[model samples]
Target: MPTPIKMPALSPTMEEGTLARWLIKEGDTVSSGDIMAEIETDKATMEFEAVDEGTVLKIEVPDGTEGVKVGTVIALLGAEGEDAGTVDAAPAAAAAPESSESAQPAASEPPEPTPASAPTVAPAKAASSAGTRTIASPLARRIAEKKGVDLASVKGSGPNGRIVKADVEGAQSGSAVPRREAAGPATGQAAAAPAGPATLPDFGIPHEDEKLSNVRKVIARRLTESKQTVPHYYLTIDVRLDPLLKLRAELNAALEAQGVKLSVNDLLIKALAKALIQVPRCNVSFGGDVLRSFSRADISVAVAAPSGLITPIIVDAGSKSISTIATEMKELAGKAREGKLQPHEYQGGTASLSNLGMYGIKQFEAVINPPQGMIMAVGAGDKRPHVVDDALAIATVMSATGSFDHRAIDGADGAELMQAFKALVEAPLGLVA
Candidate 1:
């Protein structure tokens, strides 16, 4: 009897996810804690670790499969001294079948609903006059289509001469006859963005539909919900940034020995965290009739990654030193961009900060991340005429807008938080102290 490997719930909220890629294949030896695959959850792409040490006897779910439910057996592993090849798939039958609706495959393989069952078929004979369909992996067929390699012309080298990914990759790229579509578990390509009445009229213009990744999809859903359900009110403030900029440069020079550098956003994250501490009324989440106020300020700093917009939390930013915040934020941003952030690293926050100053956007209100009371939107810092010592003087200034959830925070409380933030940023010494 072989041990069944199930699809893991990568996050607390993940119900289903895409098995983006498989690192271990059939007949591969794996130890406990070894990364076996990458699962794209609702929040981020995370590596799935192996739980039991054994030889992978069968991979029920192939790579590139989408909408695989949690607890579905994805593979089977053989114990020590067991023949990996001769073992029956009886162990797999004990597991329930997958019922992922979004899975793409030919209509002929409809009886078995899951990806694990879709690819277990006989070898495909090259197409001639008989109309016998080809047997190829979903990924192989996608590659063939992209390279225009006729499946009928290529020889399959997989089990019983089944067409697999290697066969397609080794085949020469050229013009060929129509491809005989193979019935398989999942396509190699990302699911293309659904075309529908949901989209606008093309008006006969040429266009290509791109797929929305899991991250992008979640972002869209959450942001849309935030806007529609959350009663939001905006408050804007102009803060003098020259002192902060000067302090940053001085700090960087002094800390050059420690190799710590600070960005304007880093300072702002600290300011917002401290502001939340100063005005606890604004650092809260509205849960129906309940208002939950946080004792410590965890600031969610928005960072744009290749996947989409993600807010990595700087936990207790108000408590950590400036150098500590800079270091942690840099690390988090790097991990965020690479899609490697852990769940806790990106999940919860008391307040949020989004900086468009680096991009030179002057001012804009950001949507509040759900359950959080507010998000500070910071814009570009540029030299402007400002009052100094009761006289007009030139100073570097930046505009920041706070988008507050009116259900949780009153306008006055939100304004107080903003005022505190501005004073802290302008003063520049309270943050370090």
Candidate 2:
């Protein structure tokens, strides 16, 4: 028997991926656990392995195929003693009749009592009473969705009553399938405002359109949803970093012989983790009916990659020393830039930190990554005039803004967390302790 190899979900959130490459060719013998292909998920390109040992019979999906849905059969493998020819012919035989019927649609008897202008309530009701699932090809379903044609109202003409592309296209002109309505807003909520113009006038200027990568698509969708669904509030505070800067210099000098160095961001991550521990209310995720709070802080540090911005986490960062955090961050950041981070390396976090200090950003607010309660945006530390003990002084100051999900974190708790972070950074000893 020929076995189909379907695309595996690399991560819990993964719905579709790109078939980046095929490592095994037709007729190649593969063992269980052997690498078979590379799949590009929204976050990383991961190698896919074979689950059953067999000879590769066919590759159904070619490399570079984008938007391949999870569970899609990408290849076929033949069991022992199954000839390649026979294995290849098995799938073809199953689909051959369907293809012929689709190709010769005109030969079939015309649909009776065509409901070209009338509503298709009768056919829909009949389909529902039959209790048979609608069998539509992926392409057909996509086309039907775009044309707003209900598949239930249209009778399939292909083999085994399977719906194909021709069935959808032909039904559009012959049947009055009601268009699917956009889901209404929740009760008592106003409908979303109409979207703005989709494109701007070209004005005779030539331009190229590049397709968005999976990472970019996910980033755009998630950020948009976060901004729309999460009720957000921002709190900003300025911290004097001269003490921390001096401490970091001394620590680096002492640790130079041991090959350990730390960045301001590292200390910031430690401070944030400690502050979350101090202000537990801010370290919560909104779960609709319930709220989830963690005893230990896992901090997600944002790193910009070639494809998009990703947040890789440092688990239980509050318990780790600053030097350890710095070391782990360097490795994670390197992997992030190379798109090699695994699911666990970047998945869940209690809170997030995004530092744009290296770019010299004075201050900026970041969108909270749900179901996280807050995200702290760290700006650059620079010399600024300040009042110390009622006397004018120049100190190295940095602005940190915490964006909180108002549903999960109250304004007072958010402010408290921010104040705790500021105090820790200013004192510089709590982080070391």
Candidate 3:
């Protein structure tokens, strides 16, 4: 008996996947755990593995075929002697057969179907002609096609893993993926954009303009809704960071031999989390009519990846050790840069943090990420003259701005949270405890 291999939903939100490539060819013996193909979900490229031992008997979808919905048969696998084309395949039997081989008796002893079998020998001619490669995401490939971008030239940034619009854009910008040109016009393209604009008659192909990539699409949608629907208020606080600087220096020196360096950002994250525990309102949101507060503080730290900005959550930041937070942040940042963040990994933060301190930004405000009530924008930590005990003293001061959802949090609550955060930074010891 032959079994049909359907495209599995790699992620919760994956409706369809682009069959990026087949690792094994027809007639090739495949075993359980063998990677059959690379699938492109909306989020990332992921490997599709075989759950049952069999031979590649058929492939309905040729490489580069797009718009194949999840649970659609892309390939077939069964015993070496079994002709998949000869297997009785019904509309309902489609997804079931793929799992049946592994779900029940082995290939030699497949359980008889309760329903009568239909004629097995469907001609291989009915199967699509074999292509050189699989192109994932029809929309992405179409975009690439219109832009004269090569599907093979772009690397997929999407999840089990297929190419998406971001991959194409990244390729076009000459950023993530390199361009292949011969000092002349590229193939499948017409005249390029003007280097110097002239009053030449509009001479390019007419096409409808799209707004942005799906990631950008979602970002724009969420941010717009947040700004429009959520009443926002901001509070600014200047933190005396001289104590934090000295403490961080000492902590780094102590931890340097351990191959772990504590960053000021790490300290700040811890401080904010602790302060949120004391100022519970800042750690909460208005769940429409209900006040939804969380016991655990998960801070979403904004990171700019190749795809765009993705905030990887740092869970239980208020309770986690500084070293642990630093380690987790490093890991998340690394994966974020590679666009390997999982959905839950970037979602569901109680609050968010956007730090431009390393970029030497003196001060800036942030838009609140919704459901979560507030966002903290941190500025560069630099030396400034301050009055300490009524005497002038050179100290490090950092400007911190908290953008709060006024619908959920008032000016007093925002100020209280900022005051607590300021005290923590100045003391700089409570955070470590």
All candidates' TM-scores?
0.79, 0.77, 0.69
Ranking by lDDT: 1, 2, 3
| Segments of candidate 2 deviating more than 4 angstroms | 88-200
Residues 89-194, candidate 3, lDDT per residue (tens digit)?
Answer: 5244543221212222222333223222222221111111344343345556545544556566566664224566667666663221222322223565433332
For model 2, how does the per-residue alpha-carbon lDDT over 1-433 read when each residue is reduced to its tens digit?
6887877888877766788889989889999999999889989888898999989877766557565666666677889898667753574533321121232222123322322433222112123447765765554655565555677777776434656567778876424333333333366433232221224456777876565789997887778778988999999999999999999999999889988899999999999999999999998999787899999999999999998999999999999998899899999999999888999999999999999999999999999898999999999999999887799899889999999999999999999999999999999898887
Q: How accurate is candidate 3 locally (lDDT)?
A: 0.72
Candidate 3 residues lying further than 4 Å off, grouped into runs, are 1-4, 14-28, 40-42, 58-73, 87-213
Counting clashing residue pairs in each candidate, in order, gives 0, 0, 19
What are the lDDT figures for the candidates, one per model? 0.80, 0.80, 0.72
lDDT of 1 by residue, 149-216 (tens): 77776777754355677888899887454334433337653323223222458789888766677888
Ranking by TM-score: 1, 2, 3
